[model samples]
Target: MEVLLAVVIGTLYGGGLYLMMRRNLVQLIIGLGLLSHGANLLIFIAAGLRQGGAPIIAEGKKVFLTLPADPLPQALILTSIVISFAVTAFALVLFLRTYQEVGTNDLDEMKETDT
Candidate 1:
C-alpha cells in the first residue's frame, strides 16, 4: 500500500511540476492543486501506516499496550487540505479576473498588463 501511494505521490508531483512550468494560467493553478495533494499524501505516508494495533498507550499504562492509529498526521492533512482548497479558489478567481482584463490566459500576455 505504501509503495502504491509513493508511486501515486511521485506521479502527482511530477505532473504538477510539469504543468506549473507551462504558460497557461489554468494549468498553473491545476499544478498548484496537484502539488498540494502530493504534499499532503507525502506527509500522510511519512507518518507510517498502521492498522489494528495501538501505537499509543493508555494514560496510566506505561507498558505500551494496545495500538491505536495516530491522529496527528490525519489532522494535519485535513487542515492542509482545507487551506489548499481556499488557496486554489483564490488563485482561480485572481487568475480569471486577470485573464478577463488582459484578454488572454497566457502568462506572457498577462505580464504585459502590469504596465
Candidate 2:
C-alpha cells in the first residue's frame, strides 16, 4: 500500500510539473492543483499508514491502550486543502479576467502582448 501510494504521489507530482511547464494558463492552474494534492498525500504517507484507533483517549484512561492515528497530518492536509482551494479559485478568476482583457489563454501570447 505504501509503495502504491508512493507511485501515485510521484505520478501526481510528475504530471503537475509537466502541466505547469506548458504554455496554457489553464494547464498551469491544473498543475498547481495537482501539485498541492501530491503534497498533501506526501504528508499523509510520511506520517505513516497504520490501522489504529482514533487519536482520542478513552474516558478515565490515563493512556491509550492501542496505537492512535496521527492527527497532525490530517489537520495539515485539511488546512492545505482549504488554502489550495482558495488559491486555485483566485488564480482561476485572475486568469479568466486576463483572458477576457487580453483575448488569449496562451502564456506566450500574453507575454507578447505585454510588449
Candidate 3:
C-alpha cells in the first residue's frame, strides 16, 4: 500500500511539474492544484498508515492501552485542503481577469501585450 502511494505521489508531482512548464495559464493553475494534492498525500503517508482507535483516553483510564491513530496529520491535511481550494479559486479568478484584459491565455502572448 505504501509503495503504491509512493508511486502515486511521484506521478502527481511529475505531472504537476510537467503541466506547470507549459505556456497556458489554465494548465499552470491545474498543475498547482495537482502539486497541492501531492503534498497532502505526502503528509498523510509520512504520518504512517495503520488501523487504530481514535486518539482518546477511555473513561477513567490513565493512558491508552493500544496504539491510537494520529490526529495531527488529519488536521494538517484538512487545513491544507482548505488552503489549496482557496488558492485554486483565486488563481482561476485571476486567470479569468487576465484573459479578459489581455485577451490571451498563453503566457508568451501575454508578454507581448505588456506595455
Candidate 4:
C-alpha cells in the first residue's frame, strides 16, 4: 500500500509540474491543485499506515495502542485542504479578471502587451 501510494504521489507531482509549466492559466491552476494533493498524500504516507484504533490511550495505558493511527497528518491535510481551496478560488478569480481585461488566456500573448 505504501509503495502504491508512493507511485501515485510521484505521478501527481510529475503531472502537476508538467501542467504548471504550460502557458495556459487554467492548466497551471489544475497543476497547483494536483501538487497540493500530492503533498498531502506524501505527508500521510510518511506518518505510516497502521491498523490500530484511535490514538487516545486507555485507563491504564501510558500511550497510544501499538501502531495507533497518527492524527497529525489528518489534521495537517484538513488544514491544507481548506487553505488550498481558498487559494485556488482566489487564483481562479484573478485569472478570470485578467483574461477579461487582457482579452486572452495565453500567457505568451499577455507578455506582448507589456512592450
| Predicted model with the maximum lDDT | 2
TM-score of each: 0.85, 0.94, 0.93, 0.89
Error of 2 at 77 (Å): 0.7
Candidate 3: which pairs clash? none
lDDT of 1 by residue, 1-115 (tens): 9999999999999999999999999999999999999999999999998884656676897866757778899999999999999999999999989888888888877555486
Worst 10 residues of 4 by lDDT: 61-70
**Cα error of candidate 4 at position 28, Å:** 0.9
lDDT of 3 by residue, 1-115 (tens): 9999999999999999999999999899989999999999999999999889999999999998789989999999999999999989998999999999998898998666478
Top candidate (TM-score): 2
Instruction: Kindly report which residue pairs in candidate 2 clash with one another.
Output: none
What residue runs in model 4 are displaced by over 4 Å at the alpha carbon?
Answer: 59-66, 112-115
Clashing pairs in 1: 53-67, 54-66, 54-67, 54-68, 55-67, 55-68
Once model 4 is optimally superposed onto the true structure by TM-score, how far is the C-alpha of residue 82 displaced, in angstroms? 0.9
Cα lDDT, model 1, residue 61: 77
Candidates' RMSD to native: 2.7, 1.5, 1.8, 2.0
In candidate 4, clashing pairs total 0
Predicted candidate 4 versus true structure: per-residue lDDT over 54-100, tens digit per residue: 88888897876576788888999999999999999999999999999
